[model samples]
Target: MLELQDAFARKFHYLRLSVTDVCNFRCQYCLPDGYRPDGRKSFLTLDEIRHITRAFAAMGTNKVRITGGEPSMRRDFTDIIEAVASTPGIRKVATTTNGYRMAERVADWRSAGLDAINVSLDSLDPRMFHQITGQNRFHEVMAGIDAAFTAGFEQVKVNTVLMRGLNDGELGEFLAWIKSSPIQLRFIELMQTGEMDELFERHHVRGAAIKEKLLEAGWQQRVRAHNDGPAEVFWHADYVGEIGLIMPYAQDFCASCNRLRVSALGKLHLCLFGEYGVDLRDLLQSPGQQAALQRRLREALADKKATHFLHQGHSGMTPHLASIGG
Candidate 1:
């Protein structure tokens, strides 16, 4: 087993893979102008993705998440999912998508052994949804959620990145919807990255503040979900599902973070807030580079920063979330 440590001595094991930098929608938080589809030859081939996934799986990675500019947009998405799911040691095979295209493929995905899904749904209002995603497909996303549930993917997660002026006021409404549904709702603090400043201002809502608000609104915490990632999860006493807070900006989770990121082209990033990454694609192509690649990955983890320096009024040396899987 391979053990890698960050600056704070946290052991890393999870890997988030971005299979494509292309997406179907232009979410304000993800791609403001919609990601142009890179030529098919530019993205990582299924074989390359599987090779790197198998390599990491062999080195003690149990949790693997497929992300993208929007993972659902890829033509060979199911093949990639099956490849990762079939990797020997991967205990969890999850994916994050915009949810627009999931309705048609939910059964297909589940049949391929997908574990769970994290759907990005920012607003409930049609106009606001269109404004946020630059697409008029909110209804499609909602349908996709239903399809996922019908397909037996009961552990569906909804990720809502809370922007101050945009979707903060709708938290109660969104939470109410989540309470009525079977999916968990996760609210993420806006981070200062990509075109963050141009699109929305960082709200910096601390996890404590959010908890207080929920309490004041009569929602009681049930218990934290026993999971590996850093989100603080809570449940409403009267609700069917739970709520999660990903306080990356206000309260960093670097101390307990076990996640690493693999870019669409197969570069391994040790930290989401850091710019550095090791090219694993080269290793897959070379006959004798696997051992060296493992050493380089471990060394990168050893050098991981204790906390992202974004709160110091400076965005850390990290690539855009689309470029690096988030």
Candidate 2:
């Protein structure tokens, strides 16, 4: 069996595959001000996604995340999940969505053998949430949260981007709710990816403050044996759920970074903060090229950057978070 390892000795077992670049919401952080959908209209089909997953699985990729601008927004998303979940060497198939379409199809996705889910939720207040995401689908996202638990997903993570004076005011509310909820939460420090120079300066919240508040509130810090990704996980002594801090800028965790990202258009991105990418769609389209594609992918991993540059407008990352499935 083959395995994907980078120059820094990071064996890549996780694969984040973007299923679509189309999303319903127009979040200020993720998309550009007048972003249009005309770019990269081609999305992978269920069979195409399976082919890519199988190629990665053959190289010891056990966990595959079906991500997107909003994965559930895809018409054949459930089938895509079934395809990757059924792949031979893939042990886990998860998804990250905005939760608007998940309430209606959470059970169906779970039945298809999705191992986990992570919803991008920046606010709990309906009006505030609407303001942040540019849509009035807060109720749907809330319903989706309930549906995920009712449907029995063992790992459901809620991802919140901590921005000062924005959704950061809801940190206390999130911590309070997690005490009784059977789900995990993660606070990602505001990343200055793409063209968000002003946004980064105005609303950038330090992740350390959030962690300090949690510790002051009596949350015990314990290292878990297993982890899904880079976010440092912590548990509250009085809460039923755990919390994580993905401090990309303040606390760099790049030394242990072990993952690969494939854009919805089948481009292999080495780092989220870098502009370099290798085109794999051409390889997928050519049948009987699995061995060749595997070799090429392995070679591409050698170019993975050791760390991300977080300076506003200088990260070198060309695409926005939405396009890269953050």
Candidate 3:
């Protein structure tokens, strides 16, 4: 079977496919101004998504993560999940959401063949959650998590972006909540994107501090899976759940990259901070274009850099994480 291999010999088995760029949240770090329409073309159609997934599966891709400004915002979100899950070689179908309608809709998504889910829950405090996300649906989102386990999900991952003067002091609260909740709470280091440089400077917190605290309390790091995301997970004997840290600024951060990304606009992004992307929408118009799509993907891999230039303060074309489903 053929695999998508880059010049650095990194084999891509996971694909983060953004279905839409429309999000309703006004998270402080990502979209404090809320989602504004740039009037770009419509996102990939259902047929286009099917063709794209089939082409990727044919090239030995086994996992597909549906991402977006908020993927569930699409009326056809469940249909999209079913389409990817049914692909011949695709084995895992996952999505990242903000849990807006999760309480009311997760069971339906689970029934549609979604294998895993990651929710953006920045703060466990209801008032703090509101302050951070610019929304008052904190209780609703928490209930949505309960709905996930009730719907048969084994583990539900939560993404929390760590910041200095905001929710950074709640690490102990988070650890206590996950002690028996079966949640894989991930603490992501606040990254410097193009538009949020000022905010990044004001709130950026190093994940190493939290790591040190965990180590002092007896947390042990675990080996990462071949297709897992870039999280350094740690487990503790007293807790039923685990903790993961995503420190993008760490040296050799991209050395173990085994995934690729395709923006909702049908362009393939070689790196999250890549300068540009290659258009794949043209080849996704028909079923007969699979072979050509595979060839294009292979050609595009050669353009991926050995590592991103973020350490040098170059954010490339990414103005914000919501634009490309970061």
Candidate 4:
């Protein structure tokens, strides 16, 4: 079987496929004003996505994460989920969403074989959520959270981007909320990606500081034998769930990177902060081209950058996160 190995000898097992570059909420750090997509097809059809997944699964990929401006925005989102989940050799399939419309489909998604769900919820307060997301649907998102838990989905994570002078003041609230819930809360360092150059400088919060606050508040670090990704997870003695800090900019883990991103346009992105990728969409459009697609995938994987420029000097406004399925 084919296996994707980078120059650093890291094995790749995770793939994030962005089905759409359009989103409902306009989060400041993600899609600010003047942001535009590459004008590719609105999304990859179910068969196209399945073909791509089959190709990747042939190469030892066991995990697939469906990402989007919002995956639920698609009318046939559950069909996409089922197709991926049923792919051979794929052990798990998940999604990341804003959760504005997630409440209505929790049961459907779970039945469709969604292994997990990550919700982008920077602030719990209605005003703060609206100001940050350009939407007044905090209640709806909150309802979605409730519905997710109620639907019997075992793993639901909340991704909170740490932004100073924005939602930073809600750390205590976030911690308290997660303490009593089954959902894991992951605090992400505000990254200077997409149209977030100014926002990163103005609101970036060090991950160490967030960890310090958590430690001070009695959250103890649990040394795990294995970690899912970049996030360093922690937990309080009494809590059943975990709190994670994802500091890609502060801590360089590129040597151990095991994931690649497929954009809505069908380009394979090697790194989040990378400026280049291999176009797999056109390659897969023609029948009997799986061999060529696999060759291109291997070529791109072999040359994957050892590390991102964001960890070196300045992380100045990288590619749009929506397109890359952040």
TM-score (all chains, Cα) for each model: 0.91, 0.95, 0.99, 0.93
Sort order, TM-score high to low = 3, 2, 4, 1
| Candidate scoring better on lDDT of 1 and 2 | 2
* Number of backbone clashes in candidate 1: 0
Ranking by lDDT: 3, 2, 4, 1
Model 2 TM-score relative to the real fold: 0.95
Clashes of 4: 0
User: Candidate 2: RMSD over Cα atoms?
Assistant: 1.7
How would you encode candidate 1's per-residue C-alpha lDDT over 1-326 as one tens digit per residue? 77655668676668889988777777777677667555653768888887777767767788888898788778889998899999998888999888878899988998987999999998889888888888999999999999999999867899987776777788779877977787788888777774565553545445567878877877765553323566777776688888888887655566677788888877787777776677777777653666777777777776777877777656555535676767
What would you estimate as the lDDT of candidate 3?
A: 0.94
lDDT of 2: 0.83
Per-residue CA lDDT of model 2 for 1-326, tens digit only, reads: 87898888878888999988778888878874534677637887776687789899999889999888888878888889889999998888888888987788999999998989999888989998888888889888989988998899766799988788878878778888888887789999888866777888899998888788878888776673322777878886688989988887654578777788999888898888777778888778654888888999999987887787774456775557877777
- lDDT per residue, candidate 4, 175-275, as tens digits? 67867688789999877765566778899899998788778878887663321667788888888678988888665556668888898778898887777
Error of 4 at 275 (Å): 1.4
Please identify which of the two predictions, 3 or 4, would achieve the higher TM-score against the true structure.
3
Off by over 4 Å in 1: 36-41, 200-208, 217-227, 286-289
TM-score of 1: 0.91
* Model 1 / residue 181 / CA error / Å: 1.8
Candidate 1 residue pairs in backbone clash: none
Worst 10 residues of 1 by lDDT: 220-229
Q: Candidate 4: which pairs clash?
A: none
